[model samples]
Target chain A: MISEEEVKHIAKLARLGLTDKEVGKFQKELSSILDYFEKLKKIDVSDVEPSSRSFAAENVLRRDEIKEEQSKRNRKLLELAPETKDGYLKVKPIIKFS
Target chain B: MEIKELTIKQAHDGLKKKEFSAAELCKSYLDRISKKNREIFSFLEISEDLAMNQAKEVDEMISSKKEMPLLAGIPCGIKDNMLVEGLKCTAASKILKNYTAPYDATVTKKLKAQNALILGKTNLDEFAMGASTEHSAFGPTKNPNDLSRVPGGSSGGSAAAVAADLSIFALGSDTGGSIRQPSSFCGTVGLKPTYGAVSPYGLIAFASSLDQIGPITKTVEDCKMVFDAIKGKDELDSTSVELSKIAQAKYDLRNVRIGVPKEYFVKGIDPEVEKIIKSAIKKYEDNGVKIEEVSLPHTEYALPCYYIIAPSEASANLARYDGIKYGMSNAGSPASKLLDVYLSTREEGFGPEVRRRIMLGTYALSSGYYDAYYLKAQKVRTRVIDDFNKVFKKVDALFTPVSPILPFKIGEKIEDPLSMYLVDIYTVSVNLAGLPALSMPCGKAGKLPVGLQIIGKRFEEDKILEIGKLYEHF
Candidate 1:
């Protein structure tokens, strides 16, 4: 079972500001969740292939063609934005300038 | 006839006879939306004028004696997760609440090619994270059958809209039974096409590999039409497969085998669900199809494996929402750091369940637990797939309850994440095996609906569709 401290650490890593009440609530919830997952330990999945997709057809081929995206036609696309500057939208800058 | 109740086929025939102009039909749907969507909350935004204009174009094409598009003027609701050019694609999250899509998803492009009138985007659990639409930052969509009950989700809005006849059909993305369960709850036919049968180019990523775009309609025939229009290879999505070229199934039940896993019929399954399923099995027996009780001993492992794998993929797919690329930007940050912008943007943008899943996923994928959890889950996933393959060799298709229980009260399982996760138990294994599945309204448990699932071998959509259509007829 995962500890409350570990849950809190994960919450921080996930950038969530949880109330102590929420953290405590989630601790019990996550423990039960992990305990239920313990059922997987009993199953033997050897010799099985992990399918990445459901369709059997492979090499989904398309004619190689280059097409220009119509960037000029839809200026209304960005009109709903709360902020924009010089063809690029400006908001609180996301990346650290350092 | 009420415009919303008519099937796409019926609507197409109506257009051919010029009984009602496409604009008139669009107006009918709009009228219904204005009347009902306020309470149902099925639609986040409805483009009445835009839909009518598009419908007028379809009318013109019909009058010109031109070839009609398959879904011409058939109104469809797009789940908010899918990007429709110039429309809001918020995925029911505040983070991108007002975000307009820069481009259309390939599925949307295909639907548009058929001149399908897109009515509006439907709400969903934020980023399609939760089973119930309760996690939506916008607000929860109340089930049309019972206002106090939930429309199973994160595709709840789409299912509810279709169930209430708000739209003739709708598009929903299924990541761990989102499409199927909601379809079950809403009493609509929902098909989660073989993964990659439909392109995912414009669907805002939520567990990419498991995510599939499909139709929630009134019937399996409608599903077949929508599937035909949308299924194909697309250059935009490397994962989209060329399914049209695949061979159609030999449609006969005489030699076919249907696998009914014993694990699916065990405790915790509501008696009403079992009653409806037993009746469906009887129909298969009446059709002279063989039914053998099979074993998927690893059935219990599916929930854990799905949680681990889906969230792990979700963590990777959702990494794009870092405030800079797209969506709501965090302004007036308490901290001047870029990481702060990222954290606060996500924290504010995502709803509770989404945040919880992300944190759980991040921890599972963390260095210390990577091998012990994520890798171990992958190994188990392989086993689950093996179990299906071994069973499939003996059975032509598989059958299970779409969900273990009927749609619960709006707040029933929301507080309990495990209970919420348990709802997907029967549906997730199909995804794990990467096989096609269909959910058709078999019967109702009191006022709530139950879906009978038909699982097909990889790329055997035709077989599944045939069986689903047969069962639907019965």
Candidate 2:
């Protein structure tokens, strides 16, 4: 079973601010879920390789030259930012800059 | 004849023969949605302007001598997760409630190119998390089959829209049985095409590996038509697979080999649902097709494996919703409240189920636990795929129940997440294996509907369509 401290750590990692009640709820529920997942330990999966995707695919690349159409799309995407300046996304810094 | 109830093929033919104009077709659905949507809560928003304008274009194409494109003028309800430019693509969460898509999704672009009339964006479980639409911040979408019951979710709104005749057909994304279970409850035909079969270019990532978009229609034929119209490799989604140029052998019931996994009819299944599904299997036997027992031995582990993997990927995928991007941002000071922006924004934006998943995912993918949880699930996932590959070698298709139970009441499983998660037991394996599966109404148990699931091998959608069409009564 996972502890409340672990749940708090996970909440921080996930960038979620949880109330004391919600954290308590998650501590109980997540532990039960984790306990349920304990069943996987019985399976001997040593020889098996993990499957990340359903089907095989290769990275697709196109000519590296810039196209006018792409610039138009970039402008549109920039508009989705909560704050932007000079066609660039603007966000507060994690560290102080001199 | 009810214009709102016409299948895609019927509507396509009717529009060609001038029996009704595209505007009339659009108006019929719009009119129905306006009248019935209040009670069902199927639609999050109705794009009347987009529908009318697109309908008028189709009408003009008809008025002139030009031939209508395939699926043109047939109104469809889109799950809100798909980006439809200028329409609010909320995925039924407050985070994106006010966020309008800047550009069209690949599927939306294709549908528009064909002149398909889109009714509006429909509700879903927030971020497509839960088995029932009750998880929606917008509120639950009631099953049209029984008003007191739920339209199985997270695609509940899409299924309900089709079942209630609010829209003729709809698009739904399935990540852990979102499309199929709801289709079962609502008595609509839903197909989760092979993973990578349909492009996921603009589908909001719930669990990227498990996610797929497919049709929820009134008939298997309509499902096939919608699938044909929307499927093709897109340059944007590298995971998307191209339809093979080599023609696949046409499948017919007389020569088909279907496998019935004994594991599907396990205990905990509603007895009435089991009886009805047995009858569906019997119909296939009554036909000339070959049926035999096949074992997907790892089936028992699929649900637990999915719970780990899906949330793990979702935790990573949904991290993009941090404030300072185009979504509902928590208003605060930039420097001190910067961390608060992400925390407060997500806290306010996400619902309980979404939070539960994110927390579970964060824990699973966290350091020290990744190998035990996420990595272990992936290995099990590989075995799940291997199981299907082995079964398909013996059978052309596999038949199973979409959900173990019938359309459950709205509040019945709401508080119990485990019970709600179990409703998808039979369907999650298909996603885990990346195979094509279709759910169609087999028979009724009491007043509720039962769904017969037809699963096919990787990218063999043609086979499932043939099998599903045989069972589609509507």
Candidate 3:
């Protein structure tokens, strides 16, 4: 079962801004859903390996040689930014100092 | 009078014989969309200009007597999620409302190479999250079969478009029955090719591991044609594999072996749907195909396991939608702290179901719960895959219902998330196990349609498609 505080914590971790109504709604709803998940307790999965992917394929890697050609999607990618100045996207500074 | 309701084969034949110009075919579909889309709400955006231009080029190729591709000049609807260069690709979410694709998705590139005419972008559950199209940020797609009922979703619009003859075929991304369930409801054919048989480079990511882009078409032949045109490996999608070299063999319906999973015919399934599926299996049995009762013992665990794994991948895949990237951004908010930007933008941009999944996934993958939830789900996932592998060794394929019930009214299950999640029970296991599956209308429950699903081995879409074609005519 999920607690109200845990719901708030998960919402924050998910970067969602939940109103009081949403918080209350998700609090009740998420618990019921987790209750449904309680069915998983029946399986003895102690020795079973986790399947990270659906089917297996080797991860093919390319040689680490940088081709000097500029990406063709640069202009499009930059345009998708909320705020772009010339060729760069502006962002808030991290690690604020006193 | 109307050039509507033609299959892909017929459309191709007409173009080859010069019975109708590609422009005429394109115009007929665009005209149908203009008239019927007002009610069905199957499309979000119809690009008349682009479709006509593409049709004109096909006309030139036809006039020049060039070797024509199978789908050349054929008009189809694209699910709003897959990108088309210069066309709006919203994934039916408000976040990407004004965003136009900068490049074609691999499937889009394939469709373009054939000079196919794309009618428009179809509506969907926002980010392919919900079972019904009611979750679309725009609005729900009405079932053309019965306007009040929902066209099963998140590929509802694509299915409805094909069912209503708005397009010869449509493309839909199946992440946990998004494509198959909807096609079942709409009384059309939908195929989810093996996980990696088709390239995912351009189809917008939902749950990376389970999502596959496949066709929702009027007929099995069209589904096969569309699959052939779109499936192949690509450098852009690392998970994509070369289309398996299938041995050329005719799958005689009489010789095919089908496993009927007893777990699928459970109490929760609508009695009418169960009756239809039982009769379909009986028909297969009568027709000489070996029919055996099979136990997919872990199927009861599939729904919860999928709810865990899909959302976990979705949480990571969707992290890119933060205000700084290409989609909608509320960075201009009064609370301009970078964190506030992400919170505000996402909270405002995403629909309710999206937010719910994100929160659930964030919780599941969190530090302490990771081993208990996500890891356990994956382990169960291994069990699901093993179940299918063991069954396939005994039978060539499995037969089941696509959805457990008929298409309900739009608002019926939207309020009840668990009930809505239960809608995909019969289809989700295939996605979890990463196998190829197809959904076709078997019979009508009353006024609504019931779907028959045939699932095959990991890369054996051909075997299923061959048998599917036989059953389509049955």
- Per-residue alpha-carbon lDDT of candidate 3 for residues B126-217, written as tens digits (9 for 90 to 100): 99998889999999999988999999999999999999999999999999999999999999999998888899887888999899999999
* Per-model DockQ against the true two-chain complex: 0.40, 0.74, 0.78
> Chain A structural similarity (TM-score) per candidate?
0.60, 0.87, 0.82
Task: Please provide, for model 1 over B1-474, each residue's C-alpha lDDT reduced to its tens digit, 9 standing for 90 to 100.
Answer: 456588899999998888888888888888899999999999998877668878989989988989997799999899999988888888898888878887788988888889999999998998998888999898999899999999999899999999888999999988899999999999999999887788888898988768889999998999999988888888778887777677775656568889899999989999989999889888988978788999987888888999988988887777777776567877445667666777777767877787777877888888798766677788777778878889987888988999888889988998788899988989998877777899999888789888999998888887888888878666
Candidates 2 and 3 compared: the better one by DockQ is 3
Tell me the docking grade of candidate 2: medium
Looking at model 3, give its docking quality level. Answer: medium
Error of 1 at B245 (Å): 3.2
> For candidate 3, lDDT tens digit of each residue in A1-98?
57789988998888888888898899888888888999999999899988988887688787776454436677777887888887888777667899
Candidate 2: residue B192 lDDT (0-100): 95
The segments of candidate 3 whose C-alpha lies over 4 angstroms from its true place after superposition are: A63-70, B244-253
Q: Per-residue lDDT for B132 in model 2?
A: 85
Clashing pairs in 1: A45-B383
Top lDDT prediction, candidate number: 3
TM-score of chain A, cand. 3: 0.82
* lDDT by residue for model 2 (B140-251), tens: 9999988999999999999999999999889999999999999999999999998888899989999998999999999988888899999989988988878876367666
Off by over 4 Å in 2: B250-252, B331-337
